[model samples]
Target: MAVDDFKAYIRKIIHVDMDAFYASVEQLDDPNLRYLPIAVGGSSKRGVVAAASYEARKYGVKSAMSGRLAAKLCPDLVFVKPRFERYQEISKRIRDIFFEYTALVEPLSLDEAYLDVTVNRKKAPSATLLAKEIRQKIREKTGLNASAGISINKFLAKIASDINKPNGQKTIAPDEVLGFLETLDVRKFYGVGKVTKDKMYQLGIFTGADLKSKSLDELQQHFGKSGAFYYQVVRGIHLSEVKTERQRKSVGAERTFNDNISSEIYMISRLEAIAEELEKRLKKHGLAGKTITLKIKYSDFSVQTRSKTLGLFIASKELILEESKALLYQERLKNSVRLLGISLHKLNSEQNSSELSAKEAAAASRKHEQLRLPF
Candidate 1:
């Protein structure tokens, strides 16, 4: 196909990500916390840092780090308890700003989302300008800064959003997508974590250009299903739409012990408590699933998952606990375990034909559509 024909099929996508959301909110609510290194979560030995302020980040503090480690990284770091309700309230306000420009919004989490503005409520011709307007509105309304990335697809847009951190935006024109992706580092790819990056490095796939050199068969042989994904994304062929109503794939809850436990009897008790929490979450969402998965995280940080699919969906704590116990004994512990979790998959929502039909219809209406770019 000619370049013009290819550009005609390109869709405008903008990924908006809030900066250090949880910790930023803490600072927003307290004037004294501004410019100081602070983390939002418990500071106890067993507690984890939910979020860290930019000031803390300079000291190598980050979310999901243990509080003890975070404090060690930044000795003066202040730890504050999470206020989820307040964060949700602020998130809603930011989302409202997004809706003003386009209804094709897919929220990835409370802190970020993908917006499709190929056809927008404001009839805007420039996604770059739309992103600017959206970010400005968020700051004015919530007193928080957001970053954005604009491109022809979700993958590139998401990656671009992180280029200028905290409060900024970057635009990758349709004509620039291929060159931009080709030189990009493999480690910068959205789903490439540390383990995957290491594997890619070992395989000599250090950049998009290197990855693009591998044949499809070679990638599949090495990386299995994810190989196909890596192949397509490197060539800028991502086709995932910005879903307006993103479905929940799974619901789960987990607990990390203060100390590793080697006792099976004690582990079962902990699993039961986790099941209770998972049950409440499942019920809160009016969801049930046919598959139950038990996630075991060892003291060494190695993880294992065991799953069983039943004939029917279940959401009760009793059934969940029953299945978890069976799976817990399914395999002997490799070493002392530090965390146990219960998750439900193949949710009832995935089986909802009406929702699927609606999604299909919406996708059909936007098929092969192109946005009018201002550049």
Candidate 2:
């Protein structure tokens, strides 16, 4: 095909997401938690839910909601602490699954990713089939179900993927794309969060069709910068690129013990090791974070977490260990500890600095080794 004709041909984009990622991992690892109302996060007064299983969703539990509120809503809700290392490992496997088809893959988190398989290694003509295969591979390898959405662009593909979640697949072909957008709720449009949704409702924009009626200038006048994006989306036009180089916001290390531990001294020692490892990573990246969080899992599958916001970005081993240790001290572990984790958050400036330093260090190390006699 000629370059122009190829560009005109319908593109295939797939959005794949693991169902209830953290909670699902807990369920997969523990037979008792399978098919149960599970939450992956802390279940304390000062805690929040990181992820919740489908069963727990029925009881009004949600991510970022207070754990106490979730327990009140669902008395039987099982809270399992986050095992970030396990999640990272599974994420790597999922990414590997995507690469089997196309190298144009973008990971949004440890549980969700996007792939542009316009020209795949398998030479499969249908994006739908490729998505189905990827989901299947993820399940077979990780023992988890993933939802997929296939469309021509990232916006529609991401929306379609969530339509049929928890081991479901859906596609929006070019011919049906407009009709699909017309019927979609305004809130479902990318970037239309709670505040924007409320503003659109006030203007009688309940559906994509309603939004399509407004001129670009009118939308811009109403929404400023975002209005242009809204104008484009209602008409099925989204130009955001599937980025391959978005720096990881944070890097962490964690572990889930085979047996639950209650000794504070033991837990502190383990946390100290994890923190040291994390600091090494931060230094290697030449990056730092302003927040440190400590995660704990209990024998009963209950979880507890605490975080501390530092006044300055921390990159040294001592600083990370100190913050992690302090956060752990703040949490009250009611049951035997099954897991522990340390994570750094809110990374921005450090990314560039870290990347440069890492490159320079690698170059220097290579030079030193090359100069040394290989006798």
Candidate number achieving the greatest TM-score relative to the actual structure: 1
Give one digit per residue, the lDDT tens place, for model 1 in 1-375. Answer: 367756654888899999999999999999999999999995876889999999999999998899999988899999999998899899988888887777677888899999888877787789999899999889999999999999988999999999999899999998888888889999999999999999999999898999999999999998899999999888888878887766789999999898899999999889989999999999888999999999999999999999999999999999999999999999899999999999999999842223224554376337656555582
- Report backbone clashes per prediction: 0, 1
User: Which pairs of residues have clashing backbones in candidate 2?
Assistant: 285-354
Candidate 1: segments with Cα more than 4 A from true spot: 199-206, 212-228, 329-334, 350-370
103-151 per-residue lDDT for model 2 (tens digits): 5666788888877776566867778887888888888999999999988
**Poorest 10 consecutive residues by lDDT, candidate 1:** 351-360
User: lDDT of each model, Cα atoms only?
Assistant: 0.88, 0.78
Clashing pairs in 1: none
